[model samples]
Target chain A: MRSAADAAEPAPPVRSRPGGRTARIRTQVLDAVTAELAEHGYDGLSMDAVAARAGVHRATVYRRWQEVGGLLADLFDAAGNQRWDPRDTGSLHGDLAALNHEIQDSFTEQPSLAMALIAASFRSEEAARALRRLWDERYTQSEIIVERAIQRGELPSDVDARALLIAATAPLYHHLVLLRTPPDPHLPELAATTATLAAGAGAFTR
Target chain B: MRSAADAAEPAPPVRSRPGGRTARIRTQVLDAVTAELAEHGYDGLSMDAVAARAGVHRATVYRRWQEVGGLLADLFDAAGNQRWDPRDTGSLHGDLAALNHEIQDSFTEQPSLAMALIAASFRSEEAARALRRLWDERYTQSEIIVERAIQRGELPSDVDARALLIAATAPLYHHLVLLRTPPDPHLPELAATTATLAAGAGAFTR
Candidate 1:
């Protein structure tokens, strides 16, 4: 496998612990894997290829990742780190719109990255499992924002925080995969509108 | 290329009137293409395979689709046929929730089919293009429902219809791809909440 670290753009380390030899090597390998995923897409990303890209022995890479699927799961989670914090914007619409815009920019800006991961997930159970890890981690962070909205009475107490969060991000993906268009610049506006529609349903106060 | 059509799935016969023999063969080829896509996805699909599957000469398949991408565009349009009449329900929340639930159900009930199409979309530019065609068609249809809500004074007229639709659907895709989990049953409630929140936004009512 080639050292893929240089081939693909660097993704944020998902759960790396700093200052350890083994951890550092694993990080190196993961970086390589991510680079390859970005460059080659899933069909072309093989364990052998990743090892070569990382300048690590194929056996060493295999020892860590086990299979192509496992490696993908690890790298995907590592790359898709959700680092945003939702501060109180004091308005539900603004908060949702801001979050929506940030997320939309991340996905749509490098759509191929999202597309590759999505494609890989469909083909490999491992990729799908890995993607879930990222989704949940990010969801947890978003849940905090929704909870705050409830606490402030900006939203209904009964609204399912998780549901609203999902609704908030759904449109950008829909625009890309289904609509086959670049997400609109008005994504923040869209998020606010969705938040309003959901609120009208009494999801917020409930 | 293999005939993926379920023998039981009847092909709508082409009317004799219209484009004559050329049209008939084109329709047959497209029908065959749709069945193949449903079965094998885009990566496994090729013109040679299509020609073989359709039992038509390679020349005929080539003469029509010309490129695999073009063929997918045709099939994508064919596959996306979602029709739901708007019901005022007086309560926009309940109405939208029901719609969100239905869309989520469609994807969840057919994981393999959804996966195949989504995967195919990533591999082939044609498939992606075609997928977009279908998505836009559906989006347009769904927008009518939201538009009606605004007219009824149940929603703010300024709310972005496209955004609301995306928020309603994004979670389903996220669950399918990242979570690798079945869609949540609570999607309608989530959709309702999001809608309500958006409609309540200060920017919405004005």
Candidate 2:
């Protein structure tokens, strides 16, 4: 029988790469953690378990992440930085629709990332800090789009850009995490509708 | 030293009282758990810590919630079920504004509930399930307002009621959770702006 300590030791490298073996191993372990999180959740997550899953030593995980919360923060940063550059769709509606499509795909395609980050936020201060970091990044990124709309006169000069952005995607998370439903196809439309409303509301103008 | 086995024992009677001393203990423990969550966040929360805080036996906390996940679920349920009977403001905007105010207060005042649940979700399947249950209750409650508007003919008959309801509250959560911002004081004005947009978009009619 394996003692908890045995599961926690560091292991030899998994993939031999020409450059940055350390980075590669880190990626592999984080990937393993993400998979385990999708399957087992946070309580089930352990350095020992992650080590076994990643084929890395428990010591390796501990060395890299320092703690489970630290490991998750790195994973969340990687996930949040997953990209979708905005296209010049010429119309606010078109750009918003495109943006919403990208988000919908992100949510539908890689649910584990969302689930894991959300789960971590509840249990770890480190995870909360990491999550808040991602949240800020997201807000900043989305604001750029809304600001462009304002400049283009597709939106009011006084539009509540932050409010518009929140109205757009908040429901999807709400549905996935809270309501336990796959977000509806019409969600993007509703989001666009809300953004357009906020843009024209001129709340920011006052 | 307290072994895990010892912690697993069924709780003894906490005290003889009306409303079942066990139930009172349960409530006390739950309140302690909630307070701990609010003060320290999920990572800082521990069953032993919660027991110590509540002045109850560690066995009592474990027996009631079963695990950190169970404790979170019960807390999630309690907070989510904090009900508000909607007042008839005789207009869609008025009703929505009022609802948004209540929601803003709920999350802003008790941010720990959100933080704990998110952290727990990372670690426990049961916590995720509990979160979803609480959310379902909120979604259903919010929908009632939309239905009321429809019944009153303040909006067209053919609106996507579900979408409308989601639109109304999703932004509130988005600001709280994602943006980490306290909602604007003029939330009613914001809601009114949305109602105006909905009316013009013929979101319900079309």
The TM-scores, chain A only, for the candidates as listed are 0.82, 0.77
What DockQ does each listed candidate score? 0.48, 0.34
**Best by the TM-score measure:** 1
- Per-residue lDDT, model 2, residue A197, is 53
Provide the TM-score of chain B versus the true chain B for each model in turn: 0.76, 0.77
Predicted candidate 1 versus true structure: per-residue lDDT over A1-206, tens digit per residue: 00111113553443256667777777778777766777777778888888888788888887878998988777766655524466567767777777766656555545256656666777787777776766666667767777777787777677767666666666655665445576678766755565556565565444
Q: For each candidate in turn, give its C-alpha RMSD to the true structure in angstroms.
A: 5.4, 8.9
For model 2, what TM-score does chain A reach? 0.77
Per residue, candidate 1 scores C-alpha lDDT tens digits across B1-206 of 00111111223433232677776776667667656766676667789887887778998778777988877666655444323354456666766776666555545553245555666677777777766666666667667777777888867777767656566556666665445566667655765555555665532433
Error of 2 at A188 (Å): 2.3
